[model samples]
Target: MIVEDSAVVRHLLAHLVSRDPRLELAAAVASAEEALAEIERVRPDVISMDIRLPGLDGLEATRRIMAEHPTPIVVIADAVEERGLRISMNALRAGALTVVEKPLGPGREGWEAVAEAICTQLFIMSQVPVIRQRGIGGMGAGPGRAASARAGVPPFSRPSMVGIAASTGGPPAIARVLGALPADFAAPILLVQHMGASFMEGFAAWLDGLVAPRVLIARDGMRPQPGQVHVAPGNRHLSLTPAGLLRVTDTPPVGGQRPAADVLFDSMARALGPRAMGILLTGMGEDGARGLVAINSAGGITLAEDETTAIVYGMPAAAVRLGGVSASLPLDGIGPRLLRAIGGTLEATGGQ
Candidate 1:
């Protein structure tokens, strides 16, 4: 289904969907209200939604759809303006799987390529399995949780920094983890989320609103501080120097990601050693597996989201298979676990 208000853009999207052999358009509606009302009948495997709509908007529609009928949704926006970018990010936070820029207008250079990109994204998103919106709470007690509590904050280590990596169904996952943290969270956090370049600024802004911690786009020479979360900018590899200052690199993409989680994890391992905490969240690839291994080998604590709660379970599962994860926890448990680890008391109860 395509939910876009503009007739021109809706026509373009419908044309692209029709041209793709792998996709079939279920419904093309002009407003979010119409899409919501007709969604049950349309029953699209995936939805292509525009952020700006006539009524209810894409973000609210996404939230409602995910709550009632979980389906993968990809938000589309012309991200040229800051408002559009912000709205796109809001859609993602509301459970849209990914955000893509709208196809350029006719006669613009590379318009065809842009349309193809959207088609490809739609196909990819359609393949993703999504779950209904459940509140952020520990799913259930498992052996992993017991073992994590028993380990009791690995001897003689104190976490100085936190590193997180995610993609695909990441925005909401990141929000859940970070939103659970207290405002006085002492360790600075570094996040690498694979997303389009146009969405970076707005993503950071959106995250700031969701979490208690101050969020900023990581910049070269900036020093990360406690109570702040630094997000790696799009298309740039964000790493930390030995002195703990931020380093944004234009180096070639590692594992096909410029802001690869591996790059950030390896750098954090080298810089903070046993004082670092590495977290691999829900994503679609193996980008963070090796980095989690590096952190584990360096004596840093490594955690991966457990399969039951993860949106895709690919990245975290890869790390678990590689023997890199120190503890695999559900989404809600991660924040509490991290706080305990940081406080040097990884007990079952609230030591942190």
Candidate 2:
């Protein structure tokens, strides 16, 4: 399904969906109401929706769809406009799976590449099965779990700090993982997302509403505390001090990211070592791979979202290929699994 107010953009998006052998357009409409109706009736595997529309708009439609259908939805928006960009991100928070900038047109030079990106996301979304098990699933008897146990990674001596890194379709992806955690969660979570300077604050705020943890933009020099979720601000690197202090830096972009995941993971390896639980979610680059290896070397437990659930498999796949990921679980398993990793019981866990 494609939902856009402009006739030209709608037609172009429909054309893009038609090009993929695995994807078929169920409907294309000008308003969110009609889009919602079509979704209720068609129950598509994926949706390419616009951020702005005649009624209800895309974000609201996405929120309602998630609350009702819980199907994967991809939002389409213009990249150049600030408001459009913000709304597109908000749509992600509303449970949309990914966001792709609308293509220029069939006549435009880069249209084929744009269409390819859309098809790729749709195919990925179609393949990810909804996660069912809570806490830890099977006792895989893998070396990873045995190593974590030997290191005393769980049942901590003190409050553990959580570190995560992501990019590309990270906003909604991370939210889905974190939203499963409780507000009074016993640990502190720090997130490093590869996004521009303008979007982090709003993203953090949007996540706070969805999760029990108090999500805040990380500040330099703050001491680690439980029940708080801190997100690395845009255009700055976030690292943990050996003293367990939150250190924010305007360092050179590592892996082409100012708020690079590698820097954060390296710092966690040095500071918290085996006491930290490091997670690498979905994204398009190899930003977190080396750092995850560092964390694994430090005896800390590391997890990567499995390829099945990732919006873009690049970052997590890199970590997996590097042999840094301790356990590769689906997105829905992350929150509950993290709780179990911290010694919480499966019966007590709950999240949408």
Top TM-score hit: 1
**lDDT tens readout by residue for model 1, 1-352:** 9999999888989988998999998999999899889989888999999888876988789889988989999999876777777777777766788988898677888787777878888998899888776534434434454334554555637788999999887887898888778766778899999987767888898889878889999999999987789999988999989999999999999998989999999999999999889999999889999999999999999988887677788999899889998888877777778877776222322334
- lDDT on C-alpha atoms for all candidate structures: 0.85, 0.75
For 53-134, candidate 2 gives per-residue lDDT tens digits of 8779888887777777777777777766667777877776556766666788776876776778777877777654433222
Q: Give the local distance difference test score of model 1.
A: 0.85
True-structure RMSD, every candidate: 3.5, 7.6
**Alpha carbon lDDT of residue 257, candidate 2?**
84
lDDT of 1 at 171: 87
Clashes of each: 0, 1
Window of ten residues with lowest summed lDDT in model 1: 343-352
Query: After superposition, which runs of candidate 1 have C-alpha atoms over 4 Å from their true positions?
Result: 109-113, 135-151, 344-352
Model 2: lDDT of residue 7:
93
